[model samples]
Target: MTVVLALEKVTKSFGPVEVLHGVDLALHTGEVHALIGENGAGKSTIMKILGGYLAPTTGRVLLDGAPVTYHSGPEGEAQGVVVIHQEFNLAADLTVAGNIFLGREITRGLGLDHAAMRAATAELLARLDTSIRPEALIRDLSVPDRQMVEIAKALSRKARVLIMDEPSAALTHREVEALYAQVDRLRAEGVALMFCSHRLDEVSRLADRITVLRDGSVVQRSLRGEMTEDGMAAAMVGRELTDIFPPKDTTTGETLLEVRGLNVQNLVKDVSLTLHKGEVLGIAGLVGSGRTELAEGIVGLRPATGEIRIGGRQVQIRSPRDARAAGLAYLTEDRKEAGLLLDKNLPVNLTLSALDMWGFRIDPKREKAEMTRARKEFDIRAASDEMRTGALSGGNQQKLLLAKTMLTGPEIVIIDEPTRGIDIGTKQQIYHFVRALARQGKAVIVISSELPEVIGLSDRVLVMRMGRIAGEVEGAAITEENIVRLAMGLDREEEPA
Candidate 1:
């Protein structure tokens, strides 16, 4: 194998804090190198350096073993290096083919070649086994489709060295399989691939070589079969993580929330559920199964016709404000887009939901004091409390969001995709947090696409299929096989007596 790109003794610093510490990494042709780490472990920093998005403060970038400087990402791309960021970088207003060939379009007699670009995009999408049309606008695509588009755009670059960050984070199980197939094809084509993911199972399956990063330093590097998933996790967190989920709550209390005959237009139909105090109810399903839509409808984020009861009393929830007033809170799955003000500081974001508690005048001191409390309570780690919310790591941002939601002091909580893109260590923290809420006699609803998460966290699981509750599982029956069967509509028989 040839060393296509290498980072030699690299150190990166952002003002007073140095993130990378004399790191050394290399990518070889026809191989997949998996980078595994906790959030804030500097995985993103390393990827940025290798992809020429950021220059290393101390060492050199070696292209074919020769020192080279890339002033910008395009400079690196010009040399056959491309990076697909975890965040979608597509233009929402542009068509798929247009975005794929945005800067480098085929020209014919002083005009853009739309037909040729669309044909090429169609070929790329077909290669990825996707149904996305070349003429479709990016804004109309789902999260998984958007991810595939990003991958297609990178593939269009004809990159020799390709870097991907959390490529499967937004994809469903089937879409993930499609992505893996493409990855295998790329590897067979002799493209050097490096990707970071929170999903350890992916690393176990696809990686030819694995690198474990902890606290901005390389902790372990091994060939295939040298490290187990558990070993990689231990290396990343520097602890033996025996279990990630808290023990399920064995007790239940009075009914806190009930939704009967709920309908969210065409998206969610006739969904009904009940939440009891001191219990966690898990909603599990595939993407487009209407799990999120149901939650959004219940919380008044979407228009819905339903009979909602709080504390055995009927209530009308026309908006999120009404839901909040009725002692209900919702944590949106798309936290970056819908939940928080990315450019705002901590105090502002923290106190935005519960501003009524402070009356007409906003008190800066009280807000900062509450933020300080939340940092301690939720274990939110950041360089400074005054920093923009977007600058924090995914785990820390999630914790901050949890804290913000809790500030509303709701008796009923609905958390959607609680650990969507966070690291393992933070996931454990969140699981414990949910269990603690249950212990405090609060009713909680957890909606997730990860079956293991639902089985481990919920006292009872409701499987959603095409906008309705397909079936329910509880106790010893909440297994992946059972939930998947329900989500896929493979089983219609009643539960065993």
Candidate 2:
């Protein structure tokens, strides 16, 4: 293997705080190097340095066996290094072709070569087996499609060293398969790949070498077949995690939320479910299986035709506000866009959801008090209470969002992808919080793509397929095998009665 890029004893700091210390890594051509770490363990910081978005305080970056410096991200790209950020970077209002060609448009005569750009964009997307139109505005595409656009943009750069941050976080099983094929092709082409993901299974499958980071230092590195998922996780967190999930709540109370024959237009159809106080109901399914749409229907985020009963009384919920008034709160899966106002301060984002309680007037003192309480109670780790929500780490932003949802004082809470993109440590904290909510007699509904998460956290699990409930598993019967079978529409034998 030939080294394409190498970081030797890199140390990075922000102001007076040092986040990374003496970290060393190397990316080899035709190989995928997996970088694993808990949130705030300096994974993103290292990536920033590698992609030329940040400069290391100390140590050297070597390109092709010689020390090199990149003055800017574009400079690094010019040197055959490119990064696909975890967050979507496409301009929502621009067409897919326009976004892919932005700042590097093909020119014909005196104007942009729109035809050539569109043709190139189509070719790139087609290579990934995606059907997204080059002329489609990014804002109109789904989350998975938007992610494909990001990948296509990266592909257009003709990168020799590609750094992908959580590339499959928003993709479905089928989409992931397509991505895997693309990765294999890139590997065969001798491109060096640095893959970062919280999903340990993906690392196990794709990485030729695995590097585990803990507290900003490299704790372990192993070649393929040298480490298991459990070993990788233990290394990343620096502990043997015995139980990832908290003990399930055994008690049940009166039914707090009931949906009968709910339909969300063409997305979800005739879904019926019930949630009781002191219960954590898990919704599990493949992406595009309508699990999210069903939740949106129940929470009035999407228009629906059905009966929604809160506290055994049927109610009309025309919008999210109506659902909130009916004692229901929804935490969306896409926290960056729908859940948090990233540009605002913590106090503002924390109180925005429950502003009705403040009488429609801004109260700085009251808001500050609430923010202080939330930061302490939710274990939100940030530089200060005044820090912008966008500036906080992914895990802390999730904590603040959870805290914000709780501030509404709803009796029923529906949290979708409660811990997606969160590290194992933060995931444990979230699980604890959800269990605590159930113990307090609040009806909780958790929807997740990770099967282990669904089985670990829920007292009962509902599997959806195509637009309807496929099956239900309860108590000790809730297992990954059972859930996957149901999700894939496989036949299962009846248990001995």
Model 2: residues >4 Å from true position, as ranges? 109-111, 491-497
Misplaced by over 4 Å in model 1 are: 493-497
Per-prediction count of colliding residue pairs? 0, 0
Tens digits of per-residue lDDT, candidate 1, 1-497, equal 99999999999999989999999999999999999899999999999899899999999999999999999999999999999998789999999999999999998899998999999999999988889999999988888899999999999999999999999898898889988998998999999999999999999989999999999999999999999999998999999998788887458988999999999978888988889999999999999999988988988989999799999999999889899999999999888878899999888889998887567468888888899999999999988988999989999999999999999899999999999889999999999999999998889999987887898899999999999899999999999999999999999876899
Q: Which candidate should be chosen as best, given lDDT against the real structure?
A: 1
The true-structure Cα RMSD of candidate 1 reads 2.2
True-structure lDDT of candidate 1: 0.92
Assess each prediction's global lDDT (C-alpha) against the native: 0.92, 0.92
lDDT by residue for model 2 (1-497), tens: 99999999999988898889999999999999999999888888888899998899999899999999989889999999999998888899999999999999999999999999999999998898888999999999988899999999999999999999999988888788899998999999999999889988899899999999998999999999999988988888888877789998459899999999999988998899999999999999998899989988887888999999999999999888898899999999999999999998999999997877667888999999998999888999988887789988899999999999999899999999999888888898899999999999999999998888899999999999999999999988999989999999894567799
